[model samples]
Target: MAKIKEKLGRWLRVAIGGPMGIIAWGISGASAMAIVVWGLQTVALPLLMLKTASWGIWGLGVFRESRAKRENPPPKV
Candidate 1:
């Protein structure tokens, strides 16, 4: 019957569409989270490495200065 077919079609649409919509939304959200995480790491990792390298260079400079001063003492009066 026409009425029975219409009812069945509507039920099938709802049954498939509801879960498909939810799955699509979840996939979009997960992809967004992954992109955000990747972007943050891309920017932050370089800055952290630069800061550590600067600290290391500064420490080496200080060590060299101290050693130089010890090896060549100032002239006494």
Candidate 2:
């Protein structure tokens, strides 16, 4: 269905865009901490791993919360 596809697209955009916006907007906290650690890491290996882990956690939380709100519409009679 077009509506379903649109909804999915919107969700994906949010998932991908959220972090980017956070970074662009200079939002801080855990993600900032991870980024600082990443930038300081001299070796590429652990940096990549931590980067993935941090983004994964961030994305998973945002996607889950977004999906829940999307899937559950308000009650109506």
Candidate 3:
């Protein structure tokens, strides 16, 4: 009687609230992911590529200097 009604009310709340909570969480998570991706694409990726290119150029200079040193060692005593 009363116990059955109370149980039914609780079950109804759970059935309605569960999916609503999941939907809200999913929407918020998707929004955050979109913002992060947009920010990375707009700002971070180009800077990273530029930094990588600079490092590659620096590495090539270092390799050329090392090759020159190996080819012409200092005069032996």
Candidate 4:
């Protein structure tokens, strides 16, 4: 249970915490590009893709934490 919490905390910290600036920047830039040019999907698309990938990395790291313990459960008496 504790491990799960730790993993959750770590994931939230990373996913929602870290890279926020980059995501925000991307969002703003993409929004600007979108507003300025309604047909430029390439630029905005990459930023959105980056945001998705960064979150994926963060989530994957956190999710892996639980598996680490589960795969190597401590010895029982």
Q: Taking the tens digit of each residue's C-alpha lDDT, what string does model 3 give over 1-77?
A: 97679557655544333444345445445545655878755656555655555445445545554555568654564
TM-score for all models, in order of appearance: 0.45, 0.39, 0.41, 0.36
Supply candidate 3's per-residue lDDT for 37: 76
Stretches of model 2 off by over 4 angstroms after superposition: 1-43, 75-77
lDDT of 4: 0.58
Tens-place lDDT per residue, model 2, 32-59, is 5665776655535655665676566566
Which rank order by TM-score, best down to worst? 1, 3, 2, 4
Error of 1 at 23 (Å): 53
lDDT of 1 by residue, 1-77 (tens): 97679557655544333444345445445545655777756656554554455445445545554555568655664
User: Which window of 10 residues has the lowest lDDT sum in candidate 3?
Assistant: 13-22
Off by over 4 Å in 4: 1-43, 74-77
Per-residue error at 68 for model 4, in Å?
0.2
Candidate 1, position 23, lDDT: 51
Predictions in order: lDDT: 0.53, 0.58, 0.53, 0.58
Best by lDDT: 2
TM-score of 1: 0.45
| Cα lDDT over the full model 3 | 0.53
lDDT of 2 at 14: 65
Better of 2 and 4 by lDDT: 2
Q: Clashes per prediction?
A: 0, 0, 0, 0
